[model samples]
Target chain A: MAFFRSHVLVCVDPECLARGAHDVIDALQDELVDQGLIDEIQVLETSRIGGCEDGPEMIVYPEGVHYVGFNADDVPFIVEEHFLKGRIVEKFREMPKVVVDEELGPLRPKEVRIVLKNCGYIDPTNIEDYLAVDGYQALGKALFEMTPEQVIEEVKNSGLRGRGGAGFPAGRKWDLTRQVNDFPKYMVCNADEGDPGAFMNRRVLEGDPHSVLEGMIIGAYAVGASYGYVYCRAEYPIAVETFNIAIAQAREFGFLGENILGTDFSFDLEVRVGAGAFVCGEETALIASIMGLRGEPSPRPPFPSVKGVWGKPTNNNNVETYSNVPQIILKGAPWYASMGTERSKGTKTFAVGGNVKKPGLIEVPMGITLREIIFDVAGGMHEGRHFKAVQTGGPMGGCLTEQHLDLPLDYEALTQAGSMMGSGGLVIMDETSCMVDIARFFMDFTQAESCGKCTPCRVGTRRLLELLQKICEGFGEDGDIEKLEELCEEITKNSLCGLGQGAPNPVVSTLKHFRHEYEAHIYEKRCPSKVCRPLIRFEITDPACTGCTVCARNCPVEAISGERRQLHHIDQETCIRCGICVQVCNFNAITVE
Target chain B: MTAPSTERDIPALVRAAIEKHGAKRDALIPILSEVNLALGYIPGEAFKEVRKQLHDPTEGVFVAESQLHALASFYDMLATKPRGEHVIKFCENAPCHVVGGKAVWDTLREKLSLKNGETTPDGKWTLVTTSCIGLCSVGPVVLVDEDLYGNVTPEQIGDILGRYE
Candidate 1:
C-alpha cells in the first residue's frame, strides 16, 4: 500500500521472458536492495511496451524512459545510476522511435495521412485548433464556389469509393439522394463501427471530430437535407462525446446551424448513440436503430439512399468515408484520385494487429502490396516467426495467404483474391496461429453477432459453428469439410442483408485457402498448431525440465506434483489445459502434442 | 454504485427520461439508455411506464410494452435483468483470440467462477464476452465498467479484477 517514487515496468511478454527477462528482473531487484532503493522504487511487470525484438525491456517512470536489450549483467549499473544517482543509463536507453502517440499508436514510415491528417496533430475538443488547420475551409469552398450538381461531379471525378466494406461510389450515392425530391431528407453519419477489429473510424471520430462534421455539413448542403444524425456506437463513449462537442462548436462557428456562414444552407446534426448491435453497421439496420427500433435489417431493394430514417431519403456514409470529404473538397478531384489505383482512390487506414512486431494503425495509399503493409509497415511477424495468413476485414472478411502477399490492397484486387477491404482491419497471423481455429474464431463471432432477422444467418451460421466446433473438439466426420462448404454457399446466397451474406466469408475463404488444415483435423484428428484443446495434450518433457517446480506450483488445478529439484508429472485427468503452467515455466519443459 | 431502483421510482424514472429526451419513437433508445444508466437494468414495470409516458402525437408513434421489452433485450448494452455492481466485458472476437486471448479468457472465468453473461452470487461482478472494441494492437482487451485495460495477460487478470472491488 506504500506509494513509491518511481515504478519500473519490465516487459514480461513471453517473447521477452524467453530471452532472460526474469534474470534481468532478479538482477535489478538484487541491485536495488543492495543500493537500499528497493523501498523507494517499484518494479512491476507489464506486457509488450514496444520493441519486443530487443528483449529484457523495461520502462522507467515518470520520465517514461524506455530501455531495451539489457541482460542481467547491465542491471547493477542501471540501478546504481538511475535509482541511486538519478542519472538515466545512456547505454541501455531505447531511442524514441517515430513519435509514438499513446492513443493513435506509432507513426510508421509508409503511412499516408489523408483521413488521419489531424488525428494526433490537433486538439479534438478545441474548434480553434481545428480551424487553424483549415478545418472548415472545405465547407466554405463547397458553399461559396460549387453548386449541388458540381459538388457531385467533383466527387464523381475523384473516383473515391466508400471505405465501409462495400466499395460503392460515394458520388453516385449522393446523386441518388440528391435526386430524390423528398422533403426533410436526412444525412446520417454511420459511426456504428461494429467490425470487431476495425478501429479506423473510431480514431477519426475521437481524434478530429470536426473533419467528419465538416464533411457531413457539406454533404447535407449538397443533398439538400435539413437535419442529420451521427449514429455512433454507445460503446465508444469518447467518440460520441467528442462528436457532440464538434456539433456544438460547428453551430457556434456557423458551419452547421441555419444560414451557415450567412449562406442560407441550413443544416444541423445530433448524435444518436447505438445500443450494442453489430448488425447496426449495415445502413438499413443503422437507420432502424436511429429510429429506436430493434436494429434489424429489412429487405434492401429500397436502399437507405432512396428510403431511410423515417422512410425519407437518407444518405449514410461510414465515419472514414465522411472524414475523407474535406480533403477531397479542398484539394481537387485529380489530386485525390492521383494517390491510389485506377479503380480505388485515396489512402486507407488499417488497424493492423495480431502476431506482428509492430501492431498498430497504419494509413497507406491504395495499391500498396500486402507484403509492404505486413513487413514494412507492421514490422513483419513477431519474434521472427514464420508467416501464415492475414485476415482482412473482420468476421465478414476472408483470410489471405502468402500467395496473395504481392497483391495490391485495393477493393477490386482484394475482392478478386477472395477477400474484401472491409473497413481496413488487417490482422496478421503467424505460423503459431492455426488456420482452422482462426476460421472457427471468426465463425463464432459472426454467429453470435447475427441479428437473427433471417433464417440463413441465424441458423446457417449456427450450423457452421457447430460443424467447426465438432471438428475442433476431435469429433469431425469425413464429409464435414464438404458440408461446411455447401452450407457457406447457402448462407452467402440466401441471406437478406450484408450480415448474413458476408457471415460465410471467413469460412469460405479459409476453406478455399487452408482446406488441407481442415482435412488434417478431420482425417487425422490432429491440430497442426496444437490449438484445439481436445486434439492436443500437455506434457512435461524429462530432458528440458530443470526440476525447478515452477510449472508445478503455478498449475491452477494442482494437476502437477513433484518433489523439489525433481521432474514433475501432469495428471492428465485433472489437467484443465488452461496453459498457465506453460506460460509460467521458464525452461523449455512443457510441450503440447 | 447507486441504490437499486424500486418499483415506485419506475414511473418517475420513465417520466424524467421522456422529459429529457422527447416522447418520440426516435427518442426511445436514448431514453432506455438513460434508464439503464440510472438503474443497473430496466425493470419490467419501467417498460410499461415508458410506454404509457411516451406518446408522439406528431409521428403517431405509441410503442407497446412488448416492443419496449424487445428493444431493451436486443441491445447488449441495455440489460432487462438485474446485473452486478461491476460489468466485466472481455473481448471474445478473432482479433483477441489469435493473440493469446483464450488463456486470458480462461483465467478470467476461473478467477471469477462465472460463465459468460453470469453475475457472481455476491452481485459484485458480471462476466460477459463482447465483440472487439477496436483496441486490436493490444489484444486480449478487457473492459471493467468504464475502465478498459489493453495488453492483458493471464497473470494480470487478478490484479485488474482486484482494482474494481
Candidate 2:
C-alpha cells in the first residue's frame, strides 16, 4: 500500500455536489499530477465538512486547514501553494463552522451540557478541533499521573451512573470487572440505542465520537483491559461511519494501540454493527449478537463482569455513560458531582419529540421536572393543543399523565412514577391523542419486538395486545380490562429478560392513569378523543356544507356524494374513517362523533 | 437496477464475504450483511455455503444452516426471500404515528397498491414498515433505498416515490 503525507477531504454532500464539487475534485487531482505531488498527497471524498452553504469545500490535514467556496478554477492555485510549496493559500481558506445550529437551537438557561459540551461546537471529523478543546487531557492524566485503582476511586466519587435505561453505577461496574482475575478483559460501549424515538446516542456518536473513545480508553485502562468494542446500531449509518473514522484517527495518533501516550497502557476498539434487533440493546443479548449468535437474552448469574465475550470478564456501559468518564476525570469528582440530584449525578440528554413546538435534543440536570422539560426546554405543546401525556423512555416505558408533569426526571423518580428513563425518549402527546389507542400502539411495538424466548413475554404479550386491540375496535367486553391487568402481572413476573419484564409497563401505566378512557371505550363504545377508527364516524353537517366537491373528489373510497353547489352526504357504510375530508375541507363542515 | 444473481454465484459470493471478513463465528453477521447487500436477500443455498466454510478450530464451533436461516429471519434488516428493485421503509413507531404518519403511510400504500412487506407485481417497489431510523424530530420519515426523506406529508409521497423509479 502507498502512503501519503496529507489527506485532503472534499465535501460531497448533496448541497456541495450540486455546487460543482465533483469538478473541483477533478481539477485538484489534475493539478496535483501536474505538480508531481499526486504520489505525496491523497484525495478522499467525505460527507458534510461543514459550511455546506459555502459549497465545494475541502479540508486538508495534518494542518487541518479548510478552504471553502472555490470552483475548479481555484484548484491550481491551492495545489501550487499548499500541496507543493507547503504554504496554505490564505485567500481561499476559511475556517469550518461548527454546523449544529439547526439541531440544537440556542442553548437554554436550564440546560447543563456535560455530555453535549462539544457536540455542536466542533468539527467531528477533525481530531485537532477536539484536541484544541482539551480532548485527550483526561486520558493523558489517567495514564501518566494516576494508578488504575485511583482512576476507579475518582469515578466512584463522581457518582456517575449508566445512562442506558438501567442506572447502574458506572464506577462500580468498572471495579467489578477489575476485581475479576480473568485475563484479557474487554470493555464494550453499548451504542445500540434501539428506542423508537430516541437519537441521543446517535447525536453524540456522530458529533463528538472522540469523547466517547477517550472515555472508553480511560475506562479500559482503569479496568486493566486491552481491547474494546463499540456496538452501534445499523440504523445509524452516519454514527457508525463517524465512529470508525474516529477510531482510525485515534489509532494513527498513538492514543490507541500499544503503549499509548508513551505509557505502558495499550488499548484499542472496533465498531460492531447491530442487525435491526431491538433486544440486542440488552447487555447479554448484545454480547450474544457480537459473538455471531441469535440476540437472545439469557439468565444472569455470570453477569458480564464475571463471564462475558468469549467467556472472559468484560465491562459494558452505554455511549452516554462512557462519554461522561473523561469529563469526570479531568474535572475533579466534586466538580462533576456538584450538579444534578442526590442519587443521579450530572446531566442527561433527552430526544424530546412529538407534539412539542421545539422538538429537539436537550441536556438538562437531573432534578428538572417533566413540566420544565416540556414547557421551558422544548417550548411546550404546539398551538391549539393541550398537553395530555408524555411518553418517556420508549416502547417498554410507561406513559406519564398530566398529574405526573411536575415529577422530577431522575431515574428513581421516573421509576416511582411507573415509567423508567429509558434512554430519554420523551414523546409528548396532546389532548387529541387517545390514551387507549396509545397503549395499544406501544403494545403493538412490544409484541412485534418480543424475542419469544419465554412464554409470558411471547404469549402473554400477544394476548394482552389482543385485548387492547379488542378495546380499540369497540368489541371489548366488561371483563377484558381485568383480563389485561392479570396478564400484565403474569408477564412482568415470569419474563426472563428486561425485554419481557418491561413489556407490560405501557398497558400497566396507561390503565393506572386512563382507566376511565378504557371504561368509555368498552361500556359506551365511544372514543373520547375520536382516535380509534372503528368507534368513531366522520359526517358532513347539513348547514355548513359548501358542496365545492373537494371532499368528494379527494375521498379515496368515494364515500361522499353531493352536487356541485348543494348539500353533501357521506355514505356511513362506505366511509373508511380516514378523516381526509376533515383535512381537505375549506370550511368547518365535517365533524367526528 | 442490478440483475439478480443466480444459484451458481452463491458459493463465490459467500466465499468472498468470508475471505474479506473471516471464517470465525463472529464474522457471521458481517458476512451475512455483505451478501444481503449484494443480493437484497439471502438464498437458502447461500446459508448451506456459509455453514460449509464457517468453522473455528479453537472453539470447535460449526454453524448449522437452520441456525443461519433463523438468524436471517430474526433480524429486520436481513431478508430471506427476494425483494423488489427498490425497498421503501416507512417509520411505524408511535413518535411518527402521533404526528400524522398514518396518513402518509396510507398514501404510500395506496399509491403503490401494496401493503406492509408486500412488493409490487412487477417487482418495482416493496413497502415495509420499520420501527424507527432515529429522525423523530422530523416525524413521518421515509427511506427509499439509501435516501432518507423526513417530515413527509401525504401529498409528497407521490413525489418521493416518483424519484425512486
Candidate 3:
C-alpha cells in the first residue's frame, strides 16, 4: 500500500491455466476494472511466479501475501479481500514458499550441457532469445555458407549418432534420407520420449527449443527439405508450448520464413503432438502418429527416410539426434568428434534418475565409463545404499549389473553388453528395489502405453505383464520363467515396431542378472526384497518386540494385537504385508523373513 | 500470432531495418527478431535505427543478441507464464507435495492467485493442475516460460503471468 495501495497479479502459467488461471485472470481483472481501481494499481502479466507448488496462486505486490487452494467460488473472495479491500487472505497462503535466485547452480548447466545448452538460457517464446545464443549460426554455416554435401561430410566427421535408441550415425541417416529419390521430402524431430524415467527430450524442448529448431532447420538443409515436423507427446505440454513458441518466434524472425538469413532456403516447422503412447517413439509409429493415424509401426523395408510422413521421403530422428546437429555444425566436425570412444563421438545427455544420489541431467563424453557417470558424476547410489543394477535406455534397454559397471557408455559398447542406448533414461536401483519388481514395473509401463497396433507388441507386452503380475501376486510357477523368456523373443521378432521388440528388455536383463530374485519369488514362494507385498508376511517377533504399543495403532488394518505394556504380536491372518508395521517398529521388532 | 505472408516493400522495409537493426550491425538478434516477427522480414529502412541501437557495428563484433544467429533470439519463449487455450501444468520436480501432488492440485485451485472454477470473467484463461513437470533435479519446480523454475515459492506466484488475450 506504500506506492498506490495494493496490487494483485494473477498467475497465468500453464500450471495456473490448468487450474483455471485464465478464468482467474479474467475474473480478477474485470473485478478490478469494474471496481474502478485500475489506475491505482497496475495488473501486469509477467513471468511465472516460481511457486507452482502453490498453483492457481496469486501474489499481491508490495504486501507480498501468498494465497493458495482456491475453489472457483473463492475467486471473488480473493479479489475482494486481497485486491479491493486490501486485506490479506490467510487461508490461501502456500507453504514452504519458493524463490528464484539467478545465483543457483545452473539454469541450463555450463559444463557438458551440449544438448540443453540453450534451453532455459533462451526464450522459447521469443525467437530473439534463440538467435542471441547462436541459435541458427550453425544453420547459416550449413546452408548459405556450406553445401548439403559439405554438411553431411561434417556430420560424418563429427561421428554423432542417432539418439532415438538406435545409435545409427546421424550424418549417415541424413545421407540415406538425402539419397532417397522423392519430392516433398521431410525432416522430423522425434519429441516422443517414451522410455520410462526418461524425459531428456522434454527437458531439451522446455529448455532450448530453438536448439532443436536450429538442428531441424540444418537437417532440412542437409536433406533438401522445406517442411519439418516435431512429433512430441501430448503429455509434454511444456515442450509442445515451447516448440510452438519457438516456431512462431522463428517465423517471426527470418530464420524460418522464406529466404532464411538472406539465403534462398525456406523452412517451415509445425508441431504434431502425440498421444501419450510409448510405442509411438518408434520411427514408423511416429510417422503414423504424425499423419493423424493410429501410432502403428509398418515394416521398414523402405524405412522412414525412403518412404515416411505421408509417403514423402523423410528422415526421422529423436529430439536428441536433431539436437546434436547444430552443435556438430557450429563446433565443427573435429571439435564435435573430439570426445567419446573411437566409434562413438560427442557427449550424451542422460537423465540420471531413480535411486541415485543426484538425480538430474548429466552429459558425459561418449567413451566415459558407466562407473564414472554413475559414481563420480551422478554421486553414486541414493543414501549410500548398496549399488544394484541400473535400467538404461528405457524398456528396450537392458539392465547392467555391477560386473559391467566399467563398460564404456558408447553406442557399440552398451549394445555389446546387453543394453541399447534407447533414448537416455537411466533409472537407478538399490538393494531394496526388487529386480523382478522393477522388470514388472517396466512391463506394466510398456503394456499400459502400448498402442495395440500390432498383435505381438500389443498382446505380447500385455502377456508378459500378465505373467509378471501373476508372479508378483504369488501365483507363479517354476515354468513361468521359461515361458517369459521364450515370449521375449516372440515379441522381439513378431512385433511390427521397435516398441514391441524392446518391451521384453527389462525382463530379459533382469533375468540374466538377477535370476535368483525371480527364483525366490517362484520356487521359494518368497520375495527376497520383501517388496512384493503379496508374497511376504509381516510379523512382530517376541524377542525383538519391545512391548511398545507403537506398531499396534499405526497398523491401518489393526494386524498387530498387543496389550499396553507387553510384547506385541501380529495377527498373521490380518497382516497385509504392506511393510508399514515393519517401518513403524524402530526396534526392528518386525521382519519380512 | 498468424499473419499472411507479406510482399517485400524493399526500400521502406530496408529503411526501417537500417534504423532499428543497423546499430549493432554485427549482432542485431533480439530487436531484429522482434521487428521481424512484427514486419515478417527485416528491410533496409530499419538499418539506421539498428545502427543507433547497436553502436560500433564497423568492428564486426556486434552484441550476440544483435545477430541473426544469436541463440536467445531464436528459441525465445518465457518459461514462467501461461500459454495456449488451456494450461495444464505438472510439478515435475521432486519434494513436491511428497510426490502425491495433491498440494499441487490445491495450488492449482489458487493459480494466478485466482480461485478454481473462476474464469478471468472473460472466458480467456483456464487453469489445470499438473504433477511433476518431470525435472526432478530442481525440487518443487514449475514449467512456465517453457522453463524449469526450480524451488518454487508460493509467494512470487502473482508475478507469473502473460499478456495473452
For the second chain, the TM-scores of the candidates in order are 0.90, 0.91, 0.34
TM-score of chain A of each: 0.83, 0.84, 0.81
CAPRI accuracy category, model 2:
medium
Which runs of model 1 end up more than 4 angstroms from their true locations? A1-106, A561-566, B1-8, B56-59
TM-score list, all predictions: 0.86, 0.87, 0.68
Q: Each candidate's DockQ score against the native complex?
A: 0.70, 0.65, 0.04
All models: lDDT? 0.87, 0.90, 0.70
Task: Tell me the tens digit of each residue's lDDT in model 1 across B33-139.
Answer: 98888887887877878887775566697788888888987998888888888989999877788888988988899899999999999999899988668788778
- Give the per-residue lDDT of model 3 (tens digit) for A89-126: 77887654445422213533223768867655666777
By summed lDDT, which 10 consecutive residues of candidate 3 chain B come out lowest?
B71-80
Q: What is the per-residue lDDT of model 3 for residues B16-132, given as tens digits with 9 covering 90 to 100?
A: 645653443322333444454444334444444444444555665444323333222222221112223434354422123322233344454555454532335444544533322
Write candidate 2's Cα lDDT for A290-394 as tens digits. 988889998998899999888889999999998999999999899989988999988999998889888888999998999999999889888888999889889
User: Residue A556 in candidate 2 has what lDDT?
Assistant: 82
Off by over 4 Å in 3: A1-111, B1-133, B136-165
The collision pairs in model 2 are none
DockQ of 1: 0.70
lDDT of 2 by residue, B108-133 (tens): 89889999999999999989998688
lDDT of 2 at A49: 83
